[model samples]
Target chain A: AQSVTQLDSQVPVFEEAPVELRCNYSSSVSVYLFWYVQYPNQGLQLLLKYLSGSTLVKGINGFEAEFNKSQTSFHLRKPSVHISDTAEYFCAVSDRTSTDKLIFGTGTRLQVFP
Target chain B: EAGVAQSPRYKIIEKRQSVAFWCNPISGHATLYWYQQILGQGPKLLIQFQNNGVVDDSQLPKDRFSAERLKGVDSTLKIQPAKLEDSAVYLCASSSLQGGEQYFGPGTRLTVT
Candidate 1:
């Protein structure tokens, strides 16, 4: 079985200020990690995924995340954020045993202030 | 490529009533999924279908919820005797290849009074 936990429920930051959203997971075996963003009144859109290779993965809109095995964390990072970045973000995990299904964390709301 | 499409973008019904939502997957996609998203929460998988066949439905509320992918193309989800707590957004997603990033539709937001 797999589960995800997004520690912060809401994160408020000023525009152009860097930010991080912490995500942790528990899986008996290897798992794939992903980050998704949803704007107000819209559906989720894939931001980035960790499948293999480099520990750091980058995605759309200057967003990136690092997959840390020892820490069991996949924290999303952004050097500079924009007002448009205000949205809800989710972290998800899927194990090698069942890649078809995903376990997602309760989302984190990002409020970027100008 | 075209994104997933869902009908009845918004629905309002009284308690004990029945409601249904529709979804059309992207062309040639072999996988379809239904998810429920309540206010202030991430979407939760309700059911999955592969080529018009059921793949996983562990989280589906079998007693009051049902879904079907008759033609392996578009799908429909139903909720009978809807309750106040049943108000939520029903999201439909599709993936061209299994285990890949899914494309989502605008979703049908249901409000039960």
Candidate 2:
């Protein structure tokens, strides 16, 4: 069984400040990593994904993540955030074989203050 | 292209009542999935279907929950004698491939009082 762990439940930051949301996964087999953002009362939107190749993957909204194989972590980072960036971010993982079954972390709420 | 569509964005019912939610996946998509999201929690996969066939449903509670996808297009999820715990947002998603990037719907929020 695969699982994702997001150590931070909530992160508070001021506008224009950089932010990092940490994520760790436990999987014996190789896996694909993804980041999703959910706005209030809306469906989840894909932020970015790490399927293969470069460890550093860039995503929409100027967000990026690094897939660290040795550490089993895929952390989301943004050089600067805006007030509109406030939302709940989720980290998900699925094994290479069963990519349809996504295991998600608890989610970290990013609250951006003006 | 239209994304996944779910009907009755919000539903309210009493305990032990039955309720159903509908979903129409993106055109030409072959894979569909249903998930449950409780307040303050991440979405949990309840079932997955590939071209009208069940692929994975190990996490689904078969006793009170039933889902079907007809003609490899639209799908519906039903709950019989609903419990309070079933009061959560039911999300429907679809992907062109079995393991491709999934597109999610707005979800149907069910409240049981």
Candidate 3:
């Protein structure tokens, strides 16, 4: 079985400050990792994904994540965030053998202050 | 392009009652999925469909939950004799291929009193 763990339940940051949401996964086989953002009353939007390329992956809204296989981590980072960046972020993992299923972490709530 | 669409944005039902939600996937999408998201928790996959055929439903509550995708485009999920634990946002998502980046719908919030 595959599982995702998000260490932080909530993260508070001021506008234009850097932010990092930590995520770790446990899987017996190779996996695909992804980050998704959900604003209030909206569905989740794909932030970025690590499929088969470089370790570094860039996503929308100026967010990026690095897939570290040794550490089993895919942490999302933003050099600078805006007020609008306040949202709930999720980390998901899909086993390469059974790609149809995705296991998501609890989620990290990013609260951006002025 | 339009994203995945779900109907009955909000639903309130009593325990022991039944409820249903609908979803219309993006045009040309070959895969559709249904997920359950509890408050403060990440979404959990309940079922998956591959063009009107069942692919994976291992996690779905077979006794109380039922879902179908007809014509390979639209799908419906129903819960009979709902329980308080079933009160959550039901999300619908679609993807062009299996294991691809999925586009999610706004989700239908279900509250069982």
Candidate 4:
């Protein structure tokens, strides 16, 4: 079984400032990590994933996450946040065998303010 | 290619009433998933299907919720005797066999009163 945890339930950041959303996971077997974003009233959008190899993974809309095996973390970071970056973000984990049932953490709401 | 598609978009039903939501997955994607998302919470998988056969339904409320993917192309989820807690956004997602991102639909929002 795999479980994901997003430490912060909400994060506020000033526009043009950098931001990070922390995520951690626990799994008995090797796993895949993913970040998903949700606009108001819309379905989730895939941001990026760490399936294998590289510790750092870049995603759409100027977001990236680092997969840290030692720390059990996959934190998302952005160089600069925009007002449009306000959205709900989710962290998820899945096993590698490819049956691929994702276990998601309670979302973290990002509020980018001007 | 079109993303996963779900309907009716919104539904309002009284307590104990029955409701149903539908979904059509992306072309050639063999895995389909149904999830429930309450406000301020991440999605919880309600069921998963692999080409018309159920692979996981451990979290589903079998007494009140039932789902099917008869043709392996389109699927439907039915909730009988709806509860206030059952009111939430129902999401549908699909992933191709290649093993990567899962495409999602604009989920159906259900409100039970």
Mark the regions of model 1 whose C-alpha exceeds 4 Å error after superposition.
none
Which tens-of-lDDT digit does each residue in A17-90 have in candidate 2?
99999999999999999999999888889999999999999999999999999999999999999999999999
How well does each candidate superpose onto the true structure, as a TM-score?
0.98, 0.98, 0.98, 0.96
Position B51, candidate 2: lDDT: 97
Residue-wise C-alpha lDDT for candidate 1, range B34-95, written one tens digit per residue: 99999877789999999999999999999999999998999999999899998999999999
- CAPRI quality of model 1: medium
Q: Which residue pairs in candidate 2 have backbone atoms (N, alpha carbon, C) closer than 3 angstroms, thus clashing?
A: none
Write the number of the candidate with greater lDDT, choosing between 1 and 3: 3
Please give the range of 10 consecutive residues that has the lowest summed lDDT in model 2 chain A. Answer: A37-46
Please give, for residues A1-114, the per-residue lDDT of candidate 4 as tens digits.
888889999999999999999999998888989999999878999999998888999999999999999999999999999999999999998898853678899999999999
Which DockQ values do the candidates obtain, in the order shown? 0.73, 0.85, 0.86, 0.68
TM-score of chain B of 1: 0.98
Candidate closer to the true structure by TM-score (higher is better), 2 or 4: 2
C-alpha root-mean-square deviation, each candidate: 0.9, 0.8, 0.8, 1.3
- lDDT tens string, model 1, A1-114? 888999999999999999999999998899999999988777789999999999999999999999999989999999999999999999999997678787889999999999
Q: What are the runs in model 4 whose C-alpha is more than 4 Å off?
A: none
Candidate 4 scores a C-alpha RMSD against the true structure in Å of 1.3
Give the share of true interchain contacts found in each model.
0.59, 0.73, 0.85, 0.73
- Local lDDT at B104 for model 4: 88
Q: What tens-digit string does per-residue lDDT give for candidate 3 at A38-108?
A: 99989999999998889999999999999999999999999999999999999999988877688999999
Interface RMSD of 3: 0.8
Which runs in model 3 stand beyond 4 Å of their true positions?
Answer: none
